[model samples]
Target: MNLFADIRALVLDAITTLVTEGVLPDGLNTDAVTTEPPRDPAHGDMATNAAMVLAKPAGKKPRDIAEALAVKLADDPRVASAEVAGPGFLNLRLEPSVWQALPKAILGGGTAYGRSDMGKGEKVNIEYVSANPTGPMHVGHARGAIVGDAMASLLAYAGYDVTREYYINDGGAQVDVLARSVYLRYQEAHDLSVDWPEGSYPGDYLIPVGEALKDKVGDVWLEAPEKVWLPEVREFATAAMMALIRDDLAALGVHMDVFFSEKSLYGTGRIEAAIDALKEMGLIYWGVLPKPKGKAEEDWEEREQWLFKSTDFGDDEDRPVMKADGSWAYFAPDIAYHYDKVQRGFDLLINIFGADHGGYVKRLKAVVKALSQDRVPLDIKLIQLVKLFKNGAPFKMSKRAGTFITLRDLVDEVGADVARFHMLTRKSDATLDFDFDKVVEQSKENPVFYVQYAHARICSVLRKAGAEGIDVSDATLAAQDLSGMTHPAELHLAAKLAEWPRLVEIAARTHEPHRVATYLGELAADLHGLWNRGNDEPALRFLQDDPVATQSKIALARATAVVISAGLGILGVTPVEEMR
Candidate 1:
């Protein structure tokens, strides 16, 4: 039961009545009308812009329409008062019974209380954390993983059929480099002196791959030529690195539904087919691109090559699909990959990329648009950097990863729950500073702990009420008369609880999972505020002398806990029943 949505519907109904009764003109567009919380809660419970948005279109004064609409809205029993404020805005105060019944709605719905059907089961593919198969996932990948995973979960909760995917980069030159690095380690396993090259991977993680290769092949490839050994070693090393990466992601509680291969796009007719689809649309051509700007004249060269007309789709310049050497450019296979996704019939495609990939966004979108003929929408979210700190000092790099901090290192330090929750405290496009010292703190300053503590506090309340011989089950509390929950604090918390279903729909539509974390923090604050107030006011306490009053208060607390658990579940964080 979304009270805000219900109120907005009532407002719309009143506007329709006004139009039918000749108080307002016909054919007025009401799509711009909105109902939301008033800026200052003292003004009213909810506010609407119905009169402001419709006055000019209906050829009427804003105040005159607002006053007439107020009279109609006030006739409803649910609306205690509808007063025109600010030139034409309608501020509404709902009856206490509306807020009082919210707890029963929450208890009835449980964790599914905030689930929405906004997407209507549209198929959505979210691809993220497609880290290179040459190494373990680093800190940047961690942020993208959490954001994408949470987004998939959020969209699913909002009734989207979501598929979590990762695109493996094994077809690139990096995998060849990984093959050579593993060959050096294989030589080292044979007790031979191997000189490490400047571009070779020096991480100790590759040693095991080398040892495993030696054990399997038994010096057969030790004396083979580059052509014979390169493919075998590349295949072997890629598999091992992917396994390591899977372990790292599992450590951070991220699992993918699909792992697409970049190599699969090569040698197959897929690349040609994707380009042909664009060619049929007159988007592909053989032309010479102009020399790029800002480069030295000596570095610039004009060459006729196979190119895609990406400029027509709002890109800065046309992008090449093939080079002069007859080799596919980096963007060619990417276009083919996204074309494969479009062919699979996903209604929407979402790519979560690191901030460094900002330049690739426009070109990628252009290809998807040209291939899908604007039928499919692609949304690219760029995740900013994460700077780690400990004890007020910048954290150091990991030797195991050989360059940056590994995702496993982060999960080991803070655990999966803390890491996932903290990573979502900021938006995907905003830079985040993760301080180990601050995140694990038990104080209210730590949002994860504060929210979990609220849930734990509710559990403690239920236990206390149970020990006092009061029935505290959801079935019992839901049947109790909650009219005694008339205190302002009690009603405010219930009102906040009513916003969950609305917030879920908003977050899903915006494709922003951080809003869930933000709302959960606000809800936790309300729960904590009411719990603290009970210390001085005996009537506010959960366990009261009267069984009916006690059940009503416990019902409110349990409802709040239900929402907290549901929100944390979307974030892939486990809510604790008791804080240690």
Candidate 2:
């Protein structure tokens, strides 16, 4: 359950009662009221601006409103104290019993402890790692995959019906290039000497696809020209590359709910339908764009082109939907893809694109806005570059991926769990430096290990308690007198656990998965702090002389473990039952 929401409801009910009794004005909007964690823990457990926001509207001093609100709030059993602080901010101190009951709530909720219904089951489509199906996914794609997949998970946890999708860029000329590259590999598989040209994909990964092609067509396509083999070979090669990509994603624990084909947009009337949707709004026209700023005027083309009036919708300029040669431009298919998402009845659309696609963001957002008539919101998260290092030096590229390090290579070096956790340690917009040696190092510098170590430490404690014949099961722990957990160190951990539901709402609403990583790190720090305290004071240890005391201490430790597991589950990382 969301304790913060419950407190806010209590605060609102008190305000409404105040209005009904004519103690305050009848119509002060309560929408602006929000309950949040105090900026400083020293201030209070929770802070609200209800009095401050209503002061001017009610034609009363903020302190007057806060003083009146405090009395009503303190009457609630959950609120230990409500004091007016600063400029009418109400600081709330919840009772120790409320914090003591958190572990019981965690145990009762299991992995669903912090799950929220904020999104109210709205449909959300998240498109990510739509890299060209030319080869296996690389390091850049890995970041997008983790970010997208984690986002989907986060939204689902927040009660949004999320669809994890990958868009196959198989309709473009890039697939034709891939077909030619595979054809060269096919010749080499037949024992013919081959040289990979500049634009061809030259990787050992394609060697097997080449062998598969030989087994399929035998000598028929072997002797044929590009006219006879290009179509069949392109189809075969695209399928092979997609298989490799799927396998790469599988290795990292990513499974797409849908793999939308870009080729389907080409043959179907979808593109026309999407364009017509925009055109009906008077957003389509034939026009000449202003010369791009800072470029040579001599190279600027003033020729008229079929363009979408994207400028009206906040684009820098009206963008071309059709090239001069009458073929659909790259943006055309993209608009159709988004239109397809909107047509699927999704209430929200999210795209996880690489940093290189930053320029495409505004136009694509405009497209979704026009297609959905501003009824749907589109959020695009740009994943910046990930720089890899080995032994404090730059990591070399993987030959298997042709030009970059493959996701498989990273996962193989550091298992999927580590890869996913480390990838999200940084914000999606910030460039990340991933060091292979540092990530796997069993130290505080390695956040993945730090958090996992905390979980494993709790497991170690539970095992020790079990051997000592102390019943540490949930049923027993729930019955423990947690009020005995009064040590400052123990209380600190309970405070961290109390923030879980609030943190989930913030991270989910912001669509920022990095917040989860940061919260886990903080939680681990609190867990470690308590463990260190136990080393100094034996009474703080999980295994006390008294079974009841041990259960009380272990209950808190197990509650921390429960929250960590729940957070990691949302990140698609398996929690370590024990550190190896």
Candidate 3:
């Protein structure tokens, strides 16, 4: 049903025929050949670089190869005409029936119109939103969560076995600070005077945790010293924070398949095992690192430390695995976490990190490469910051989250659908501005609303036709005679529909879910454009004079809705059947 792919196969077949006839060299590599929509739509329906890619290898001039290939392509019934463009590019105008039959293909596929098998069921592990279990997830975490979730969905749609994962940062000084903060809250719950220290978390979100702690063990930790209460309170507080984080993610429709604890890596010999695996490969060593740039010699101290030879595998410099205090560095646990992922037998690994973690990418990749022995590939996508706006002014931060707006705050301000759709409007690496005023607007300026409206409008059309006793069932519409669909506007929409499968493969391969949003916007625009055109040209209307003609037109509208539904489903957005 992929017209572009079908045509590309035809182009390859023609090249094969040429080689068999000895018109071209026998061993010319045609892997570089590509067929795509021409940059200028006026030129042709599709364009290919088959001739240009083969000319030099075949020992022939570009024009000669193109002219010969054009004749071979023009002989096919699907190709209306094949003309050689400026050099060796072959522009093809497909038969009108090819585009006209696309609605039938869409109806045949239903919402699975653009589903692909490009991934071949390869296992892909996507780790994202590994926010510390010390607090609720903030806006930056929301961006990474949405991106990773959408990417997992996209890959699943393209036939990858995807597992969404989250790494909990619960094994550090931060958890201890969380415990102390909760201890203060526990004292406050007992009506005792407490001074909130500088390093302790002061947010009121921990009030419930403190109350729960008091309820769990009444007055036992009240008179205890730091050593006795720290461990028990740390474990309790970490679990409560994780529960809060889970709720925050649920509110935004994000759920993880696995929640890996950094603390689990400790006391389990997992970190040591990961490091030992690297050491066996001659990558781990004890060495003195050069003083960091931009620091004075007097301010810097030279010390021998355990290090990973990350520079051997593309990092800017070797990275330390242990600190001077004889405790593991932050990178040490991360290495073990990734090694666990590799040992889990995943074919690919993807990590969605905040833009602030840019410097950690190279070392992380190097560690995974050394651990997996280059068998598994790791891709890290860094999501940039999100600035919120409301009523033409910057939105204020949430008091509950203390330093930033919580994901719950965002989901409350705008529904989960709006939040998810707006988060994907920009690429992961680009800064995104979420404006409340613009996103919820019912006009074409809002992409989510516009795309949803197209689906809803199609539903309205179907309902109206059904009420009028037009028999608008898919079976009836799919069998209608669509030969009369000859208008340029009608064919243009079908052309757009033909690109859905191609778009799916491109977006999945690039690991870019923003491309799906962009394609949906374009598809919505085309549907809206044709709907408006019907106002002037009565013949372009979906409801026509002849019953079969009306069925054909409705088929096209239903097909557009079908593709829109599929695209929105991949984005994890519910397709609205009716606009409010």
Q: Candidate 3: minimum summed lDDT over ten consecutive residues — where? A: 104-113
Q: Return the lDDT, model 3, position 400.
A: 90
Q: Distance from true position, residue 540, model 2, in Å? A: 1.2
lDDT (Cα, tens digit) per residue for candidate 3, span 341-373: 999999999999999999999999999988999
- Candidate 3 Cα misplacement greater than 4 A, ranges: none
User: Please, what are the lDDT tens digits per residue for candidate 2 over residues 307-343?
Assistant: 9988878988889998788889889999999999999
- Candidate 1 lDDT at 452 equals 91
Q: After aligning candidate 1 to the native by TM-score, how far in Å is the CA of 82 from where it should be?
A: 1.0
Report the number of backbone clashes for model 2.
0
Question: What lDDT does model 3 reach?
Answer: 0.91
At residue 510, what lDDT does model 1 achieve?
Answer: 89
Candidate 2 lands at a TM-score of 0.97
lDDT of 2: 0.91
User: How many clashing pairs per prediction, in order?
Assistant: 0, 0, 0
